[model samples]
Target chain A: ELKVEQNPLFLSMQEGKNYTIYCNYSTTSARLYWYRQDPGKSLESLFVLLSNGAVKQEGRLMASLDTKARLSTLHITAAVHDLSATYFCAVDQGRSGSRLTFGEGTQLTVNP
Target chain B: GAGVSQTPSNKVTEKGKYVELRCDPISGHTALYWYRQSLGQGPEFLIYFQGTGAADDSGLPNDRFFAVRPEGSVSTLKIQRTERGDSAVYLCASSLNAANTGELFFGEGSRLTVL
Candidate 1:
């Protein structure tokens, strides 16, 4: 069974500060994804890391994948109140159907 | 619909009652998936369908939970003898083609409350 774990389940950071959310998986899959969910809303895609050493950045959010270590990280640079939400990392099993195992998620709260 | 659509945005049922949730995939999507999200938890895969066939239903908790994608466009999830543990948000997702590794798009989800 593939397991995905994320650190700092609950995070409280002040605006303009920086933080990083870590995602570690138990399998050898190379495809990983990051999603963000607002309160009472569905998830939206953030980043798709397709291979080793792949990194993607949008705005203040950057995500990287290290397949060899079975890990991925979502780094927030200069966080803002709008960035506060629940973020999840999902690892694709890389099978025909691409079954995804997701981490528990990190709930971020940005305070001014 | 422009995105994946799930019916009965919220459903409240008594214990042991039957519940059914529906999902409508994108117009051209060939792959659909079902997932369950409990309070303060990530979505867990419940099943996957390729067209009209269920390619993988391994994540289903038990036999009491069943899903069918008749005609391949719309899918229905049936739960029998529901328990309090079944209370959670059921999410539906769809993709253009699983073989091509298309990005999965998720619905807003149907929140089920088994009281």
Candidate 2:
């Protein structure tokens, strides 16, 4: 079984501060995904990291993958209250159809 | 549909009852996935379908949980003899790539509560 662990499961940040959420997996995977979920809403894809050193950024959020280290990171820059949501990182099992194993999500609160 | 669609947005049923959840994936998406999310937890994989066949069902916790995508566009998840532990938001996602490399677009999810 593939295990995924995330640190700082609950995060609270003031406006203009920056923080990073880390995801560590137990096995090798070809794809890593970052997702954001608001309360009672669906998970929305934020970034898709396909390679060992792949990095993607959107607005104030950035994500990167390190396949060799079996780690992925989601960084928030100049955080704002609108950025508050539960974030998750999922790793695809080395198989078809993208069977994903997700880590316990990090709930972020950006306060003004 | 503009996005993955799921039916029965919220369901409340008695324990031991059977329930069915439906998912309508985006048009032209070849891959579909099902996941379960407990309160305050990330979604856990339940099954994945490539076209009309299920390519992977290893994430299913038991035999009572089953899913099928007969025509390759819409899928249904069936649960038999449901227990309280089965209560969760069942999420459906779709991807355009068969190799599982594409970004997954998720549905709003069907929230199931077993009383």
Candidate 3:
């Protein structure tokens, strides 16, 4: 089975601070995705990193994938209050239907 | 242009009762998925459908969990003899296709509470 582990499961940081949430997977995958979920809402897609060294950024969030190391990272640059949410990283099994195995998620709290 | 939509945003049922959750994928999306998320946990894949056929249902925990997408547009997840352990948010997501890089668009989710 493919296992995904994320570090700093709960992060509390001051607004404007920078932080990185790391996702490490146990198997080889061709695609990695980052998602954000609020208190009672479903996850929202953040980024999809396809190849090794693939990096994508949206607003204050940036995600990268290193397939060789079987790891992915979601970096928060100058966080804001609105960025407080649970972040998840999912890896595609590289099958036909894109079945995903997700991490435990990092609950980030940005305080002003 | 609407995103994936799920019905009965919240469901509270008694143990052993039957419940059905519905999902409406985004227009033109050819792939749909069902996932269950427990408190503070990541979404667990339940099933995946390509067009109107279920390409994968191996993630479903047991026989009590079943899903169907007959027309390739709408899907329903049926739970039988629900258990308290089954209480969690059921999420629905859709993507353009099963293409490796397609990002999934999720619905608000149907929160199931078994008391």
TM-score of every candidate relative to the true structure: 0.98, 0.97, 0.97
- Which scores better on TM-score, 1 or 3? 1
What DockQ values do the models have?
Answer: 0.76, 0.82, 0.83
- Candidate order (DockQ): 3, 2, 1
Q: Global lDDT for candidate 3?
A: 0.92
Which lDDT value does model 2 have at B44? 92
Residue pairs whose backbone atoms clash in candidate 3: none
Question: For each prediction, how big is the interface RMSD?
Answer: 1.1, 1.0, 0.9
Tens digit of per-residue lDDT, candidate 3, span A5-63: 99989999999999999999998656889999999988888898888999989999999
lDDT of 1 by residue, B1-115 (tens): 8999999999999999999999999899999999999999999999999999999999999999999999999999999999999999999999888976546899999999999
What TM-score does model 2 achieve against the real structure?
Answer: 0.97
- Evaluate residue A9 in candidate 2 and report its C-alpha lDDT on the 0 to 100 scale: 99
Better of 1 and 2 by lDDT: 1
- Can you write out model 2's per-residue Cα lDDT over A45-112, one digit (the tens) per residue? 99989889999999999999999999999999999999999999988865656888899999999999
Q: Estimate, for each residue in A1-112, the C-alpha lDDT of model 1 and write its tens digit.
A: 7899999899999999999999999988658999999999999989988889999999999999999999899999999999989999998978888688889999999998
When sorted by lDDT, best at the front, the candidate numbers are: 1, 2, 3
At residue B95, candidate 2 shows an lDDT of 92
* lDDT by residue (tens digit), candidate 3, B6-113: 999999999999999999999999999999999989999999999989999999999999999988899999999999999999999998899747688899999999
lDDT of each: 0.94, 0.92, 0.92
